[model samples]
Target: MALRRTAYHYYERRLVATLPAERLPRHVGVIADGHRRFAREMTDGEYRASYEAGMRKLEELIEWCAELGIGAVTAWVLSTENLARPAAELDPYFEVLTDLFHRLPRVAQRLHFTLTVSGSLDLLPPDLALAAKAAADQTDGIAAPTMTVNIALCYGGRQEVVDAARSLVADLVAEGVAPEDLPERIDAEGLARNLYAADLPDTDLVIRTSGESRLSGFLLWQSAFAEFAFVDPYWPAFRKVDLLRALRDFTRRERRFGK
Candidate 1:
């Protein structure tokens, strides 16, 4: 075990040394998947334990990104589609997520990061929504934050596009644009400006854990040109080495951006 630990540390150091800081991604999107599976296999189906572990891993991920000078991270913790699960499953996860939100303000302050919880809040339980709002408020006062962390709760990429479209139309209507002329006023840039976090740069890299190779509607518009790295470890078991390797791989890619 000691020897294995020593080798792991050595490999980690090597990965860090090889990473080109200038080539690192400006914004990273994470699909934090497989918490329940991790719990089932590792914790005898105690999902709360798995959720806690995954949240801790997410915190560690933020620190790692900060250490590497990454500007932003968007983590998809809960999706709109996930609301369809049975209450027995979703309730415990919601409880865990609520606890996470309650505790995140302190972490955000210590890490000097701005936290934004973006999603369809009306669909969530009142307590969860309030907790998320409070956490965001607590972190909003940070002046010149070193990084921006977006916790995507109850988010859906398709729904986000729809919301952006609705927002754009509302603005146009408010401006007294004729309904017939509204189509002309609509454009990609206009819709993009209405997205949840329009100020942040587009995602440069997307990392999905638990061996999932599909995006499943994560950042559909933003990640059009982003590179992808899908790893095998569940979110709770994802190690720093996994992230470092993804970074190294990203640096090596010749991103043509759909040219």
Candidate 2:
């Protein structure tokens, strides 16, 4: 076991050395799937413990991105569809999410990064919604943040687009803009300005684990030209080496952006 561990470290170091800092993606989006499945398989169906382990894995991901000098990261923690899960599963899940939010401000301060909660808060319980808001508000005062980490909860790509459209239309009407000019106001850039995180950059790379080959409505609008890396391990079992391998592979691919 010791020898294998040593060998793994050697390989990880080599992989890291091969990646040029300047060539790395500036924005990374991750779909953190397979937590519930992992809990079922690994913990004998212990939901809370499995979720806790998943949360720890998220911290490791953040650390790795920061070390790699990635300026922005978006993690899909909970989807809008997840809200429909059975209460027994979702109740604990909501608590965990709320706890993570409450803890995020301190994490942001310590890491010198900005935290953006991207999703529809109305779908969440009042406590959870307030926690998400508090985290964002507390982190907003930080000056010159080094990176931005987005936590996507109750988020759906189509829903986000719809919400953006609604917000834009409301703003336009509030300004007494003529209905005849409304069609011109619905451009991509104008719609984007109304998204949850309007200042966020388009995703440069997207990584999804658990052997999943498809994106389940994650970052639909923003990932139009993003490179994707799929790994087989469950979220709880994901390792730093996997992340390094993904980065190495990304450096090898050419992003043509529909060319």
Candidate 3:
């Protein structure tokens, strides 16, 4: 055990020392998958316990990002499909998410991060939605946050794009733009303006834990040319070393946005 621990630390230190800070991503997105799986492994299948564990891990990840000088971090906390889960499981999850939204601002403020929530506010319960909005409003004035953390709850990429389109058309109509001129006016910028976190930059590196390789519709629009790193551990087991490894790996890649 002593030898193994030594070797682990040696490798971790090497990775950290060799990291190219100049190549660090401006924005990183994470899909925190397999919370229930991690929970089952740790607590003999207690779903609520698993969620709590995952939340704790998320807090750790945010701190790690700040330590690494990552200016923006986005996490997929919950999806629209998750809303369809049975009440027995969903009820506790809702409470956990709501508590997270309310508690996150305090943590972010202390960490000097501007807190922002993305996705469909209408889909969240009233109190949860309000908590998210209040948190964002409170942090928006931070002139220079150490980082900006985005919690994506009840978010779907396709739905976001569709919503953006609808909002764009409505604005155009309100502005008295004729239907024939709509096609000329509608473009990437128009759609992006209406998407959640429109002011944020596109994802530079997207990491999905638990060995998942698919995006699962997390940030379809923004991650068009992003690099990906899929790790095998469930989210709760994800550690700072794993994140450093991802960063090290990213630094080695040669990104060419489709030439």
| All candidates: TM-score | 0.97, 0.96, 0.93
Of 2 and 3, the candidate ahead on lDDT is 2
Pairwise TM-score winner, candidates 1 and 3: 1
Per-residue lDDT tens digits for candidate 2, residues 75-149, read: 999999998899988888788888888778887887888888888889899999999888888998998888899
User: In candidate 3, which residue pairs clash?
Assistant: none
**lDDT preference between candidates 1 and 3, better one:** 1
Query: By summed lDDT, which 10 consecutive residues of candidate 1 come out lowest?
Result: 85-94
Question: Sorted on lDDT, highest at the top, how do the candidates line up?
Answer: 1, 2, 3
RMSD after CA superposition, every candidate = 1.0, 1.3, 1.9
Model 1 lDDT per residue over 56-131, tens place: 9999999999989999999999999999988977898888889989988898888899999879999999999999
Alpha carbon lDDT of each predicted model:
0.94, 0.89, 0.88
- Give the number of the best model, judged by lDDT: 1
* Candidate 3: tens digits of C-alpha lDDT, residues 1-259: 9998888889878888988789999899999999877866887878888888788889999998898899899999899998888887777777877777777778877788998788887987888888888988888777668898999988998998998999999999999999999999899999989988887889999999999899999889999999999999898888878998899999999999889
Give the Cα-based TM-score of candidate 2 against the true structure. 0.96
lDDT of 2: 0.89
